[model samples]
Target: MKWTRAVHHLTDLVEKVSEMPGTHFRFEVVELWVFGDLLGAPRDLEHIDVALVVDLPVDEVPWLTEPLGAEHWANASRVSRNPVMPFWRSAQAPVWNHRIERPALAWSKADGIAEETLVAVGDGTGELVRLPAPEPDELRKRLDDELALSLAALRHDNQVYTDRRWSPGKLTPYADALWRTTTGYLDLLDALAR
Candidate 1:
């Protein structure tokens, strides 16, 4: 599917879910974020990755004995049986493997909601109308932060690669590749800052 269409579908789905009666349970979608290849605006994409930060009211789940235990159990059970579990799993898969090193675009629920937030609303004709993108300064700051993080990871990985006694030579290639990536980010940041 196209990136735009996928985004539209996601927005519609979220809206529908949000409109569902809160009688069964109460929850809030605090934030929605899109990351990975979808941000590149490719012509076609296999899937769009999104992270939804939700707040489920534990007070509603009275069956549990303790509040703290209820919070934990509710979170676990929510993920296990969420209607969009597949998408949720995909969105979180990168976190477990430390692959979400890149920055994400935060999809805001409405204008003036938050900084660096993107909003897309339906036009009532099956098309989506996106709000303005973040300001240049915001974009630059995000890139700068990401570059700093990448550099830190590179330094830490370098230490591990050099200290290991066995197969240290094997790590050299991976280290070099990471160095190249770090430099690429630096170059991109420099260009953006210019």
Candidate 2:
């Protein structure tokens, strides 16, 4: 599935959650990514992993870490209770602070609210670690650095995939996806620079 579809799914979930009576959860999407759920099955990858920041009353915070995994649905692998977290606990990344305009996704009941996503990865780290958000100038520098790294990795992967020396077989699609992600980051950098 295209990443857009996954994003739509997230939007729907957010809308639904927001409407539940007495639920004071506020959600902000922070990141979108695609990868094999397991390292051994790269070719069987499906669905986009979304990172979000949710704000709720402190008394209701205990339910956040419940062992409820994800609920498998038609196109989505699992749709678990969206993680409940503090605003600062959202994915830490160098995001360009521009408002996103998705009318359908943005809640209309409230005024002056724009939906956004935070990006993060869970790389086998058993515990959650907090990474503080950097200053605006520092954030720009970090974003620039990350953009350069992504571009360099993309170039190296492109060369490897086309070298004709190594046969990647099924992994070709994976490399293609990586290239797309790299280009996406470049696009983001361009937008931020403007």
Candidate 3:
């Protein structure tokens, strides 16, 4: 689907999930990517995925998917360790592997709400209404703190996995990617500050 429609669809879906009876889940759109068309991505890639950072038990996450009424895929929550190969990060990764990285579409949180911008234009005029994006310094400090926590978690996981002679698990790569992205964001913020 087109990017704008995808945003609307995802927003609607998330809202529905939140409003479910007896549901006490809090989620934020940490990342989103709307590709192709007027967007910069190649035309062949036409889809959107919103990465939500949610506070809920992993077992309960499927409840969020059931409302979608589709056979969606999900990975078991664990510390999974795999090869840090660039091949896992390409356009074809989703075909060969299980995951591919993409940019975020909506990323704003205020008063504990996931805020997104919806644009509607048919005539000669348009309107833009969105929660103000977080300030760079705030983002930088947040990322910095997150990176430190991730590193600590990685250290603990490494020790436990080593004791059992077990291979790295999901948390391994999760922490690694967290470190990498957090650093990248910090660098970008630094550049922007200058």
What ordering of candidates by lDDT runs from best to worst? 1, 2, 3
RMSD of each: 12.8, 16.4, 11.7
TM-score of 2: 0.33
lDDT of 1 by residue, 12-103 (tens): 54454444343444344444554555445445666655554445332211111112232343354343233221222122122111222233
TM-score of each: 0.35, 0.33, 0.38
Model 3 spans > 4 angstroms off: 19-45, 49-53, 56-127, 166-194
Candidate 1 stretches with Cα past 4 Å from truth are 1-32, 35-44, 51-131, 165-194
The true-structure Cα RMSD of candidate 3 reads 11.7
Best model per lDDT? 1
Tell me how many residue pairs clash in candidate 2: 8
Candidate ranking (TM-score, best to worst): 3, 1, 2
Which whole-number lDDT from 0 to 100 does residue 10 have in model 2?
47
